[model samples]
Target: MSVAVASASAPARKALWKNLGVQVVIAMILGTLVGLLFPSFAAQLKILGDIFLRLIKTAVAPLVFLCVVVGVVSAGDFKRIGKVGLVAMLYFEIVSSIALGFGLVAGNLLGIGQGMSATTAASGVKPPSAAGAPHSTLEFILNIFPDNFIGAFARGELLQVLVIALIFGAALLHLKESKRLPIERGLNAISDAFFEFIHLIMWVAPIGTFGAVAFAVGSSGTAVLLSLIYLVLSFYAVVIAFIVVVLGGICAMFRINLFSFLAFIKDEIFIVLGTASSESVLPRLLEKLPTYGCSKQSVGLVLPTGYAFNLDGTSIYMSMGILFLAHAYNVPLDFSQQLGILAIMLLTSKGAATVSGGSFVVFAATVAATGVLPLEGLAVLFGVYRFMSIAIATTNVIGNSIATIVTAKICGEFDESVLARTVREEMA
Candidate 1:
């Protein structure tokens, strides 16, 4: 009996080791240890993270374009697509503004970043240029339209690709079924192929995550975390509260269990934690959300748009960061001044979705644009940005996923029975 039990357990152990989530967790732990024990060597591992992100990015433009075109064509109604877009934008603005306000309130009440002198903060670090200058509202809007179609995909510009996909998809809607069927089928086949490609790339996630965490820890050193622990803790606290109160409420209103939803997407959540880039899991989300009963149209339209527009996590970071700097530098920001900061962040936060390093760049630009606080103050956050990014990226993914479901429900596109059945299967 003992020999038989051991033989059975061997297969169980092998299967556990084969699980991706288990491997990723192990990679994160080993990466942390390497970073702590061999800082110099670990820093050199940055290339691993860079390569993984580049691979994922290469697929993003084409995947997004194909998904959007297929979604739009399948829905078969331009007016309905327009309505969904309008509602999604409205939802994004309201929720994102609320997140900004929540962050500001949290920062003021907690008094994080206080008692640190601006000179002391700026002592060692050279200030980054206000390289990400705030574009005027008109300029920002105009920039969304790609000057050349191929350039958009070449540059991996999501908003530009979205525009091209929208036009292409709308044009497809006017074609006769005989003419459209073959093209739609072709696009769907290509989109499936891209998803398979994404799966192949994901096999490297453990190595990629290990390098990312190791480089972050190795370069910054753990000592910096002690000095900025309060800011980090406060930011995390705000994120949890937002999820429980804001997103939780939304889930309750939809009669879905927030905990169950979180459990269902736990794999993607872990991936975000490892990669620190929500875009890393875009293809997975596009495939999974439909299984949860959200219409493909809503998932394709709302989820991608939410990435660019919703950005609750980025908004929270921006508001809190500004206040943290203000308090640290002893710069007195009155109600009107803080409001001005909020106003500026509303626009700059949208720009955060444009690229890697975008959140920090936009934060720098917002501070410069408002002139409410000195730009040098941003240097203080350099040590903690990577740590903070993990939280922000994870939150953004959760928020976007929820947004897709909510939008689908509002549009009456969601199938409640299918959602219930999927959740049951997942739990089992």
Candidate 2:
């Protein structure tokens, strides 16, 4: 860990608002104020953020495709690429399980949902439609494989797109070096173009942040938030504990200072918070993690894959939300029942990102599948989803960033000096 002192020779800092993080933070503050004082006006501002999300959604599938494909061919080793992917998936499963079980344990121990039937009399938000909820494990597995290759991209199905990238990478891996280089170069160029596209889109991020936060607060209002303050605070408490205890321990094992690591990615983390969607920062993370000394291959494979497979925060929220419903509605879930829910969540949570409406949609699906938790109970949460998302999305981004670096280290693709350089900036 490098601890460089602040130096007089450092360049003058730009205007604070000119910085992306500053602009986003300012937008959030303005958004909250508007939500509190002028909700109707804030409601109208939601389209601004919707437009930004649409732009990000459109760009991500292709970008993931290109990143994995490019990462695969560029490394020039099929064995190494396969190893990294395998390791990342394993890490994702282990850590996500921990997150799942931890949430249940915490929620149960804290009785996080003990009295919700009386405190918040009416759920402010209407329940979301559960039309896409899968009925069985087999149905969920089949949903992952795309029927049409081009259609997958057209539909912006990330898991399908990921499948295509892996197959494409495998095909390229088998090609003669003479033939592969040209293809790799072409793909690399396209990937660079997409990165530039993300940069262009990012300029409008503050506008989007302002709109998203405004709409969330405007819709829910402080009244709704206060009613369920315990649930909100409890969930936040769990997320913070997970970060400090779980993620912090992982970083410690690698000798990486978690605080410095978080500081290095502060800008992207803020972007996630403002947008309340982890997908918004996908393009930026793809470009940034490599600078942390993680090999491009490891980053390209692990990070994009982590978005769906390794959402520690989402798992915790889903598990806790279910327990909250069960408790609030006076439903008792036995050990076997809770385990069944956990198993369902492990599958549904991975598909949440690929599905429209993200995790909440999937959360609804998981609830419906349980055949016990009152699906109606989900309305109790809908109003506060956006607020919870601010922290949830931040946690997901932080978790994935750490997962990528750890995967890189495991695969012998890390450079200590690069991380040292990154930490120096945080220290300074």
The parts of candidate 2 lying over 4 Å away from their true place are 1-10, 119-121, 423-428
Give the range of the ten consecutive residues with the poorest summed lDDT in model 2: 1-10
TM-score of candidate 1 against the unseen true structure: 0.94
Q: Over the stretch 239-261, how does candidate 2's per-residue lDDT look in tens digits? A: 99999999999999987789978
lDDT of 2: 0.88
Backbone clash pairs for candidate 1 read: none
Q: Return the clash pairs for model 2, or none.
A: none
User: Over the stretch 254-363, how does candidate 1's per-residue lDDT look in tens digits?
Assistant: 88789988988887887788888989999899999999999988888888888889888898999999998888888999998898889988998988876446678788
Q: List the global CA lDDT of all models.
A: 0.86, 0.88
The C-alpha local distance difference test score for the whole of candidate 1 amounts to: 0.86
TM-score of each: 0.94, 0.94
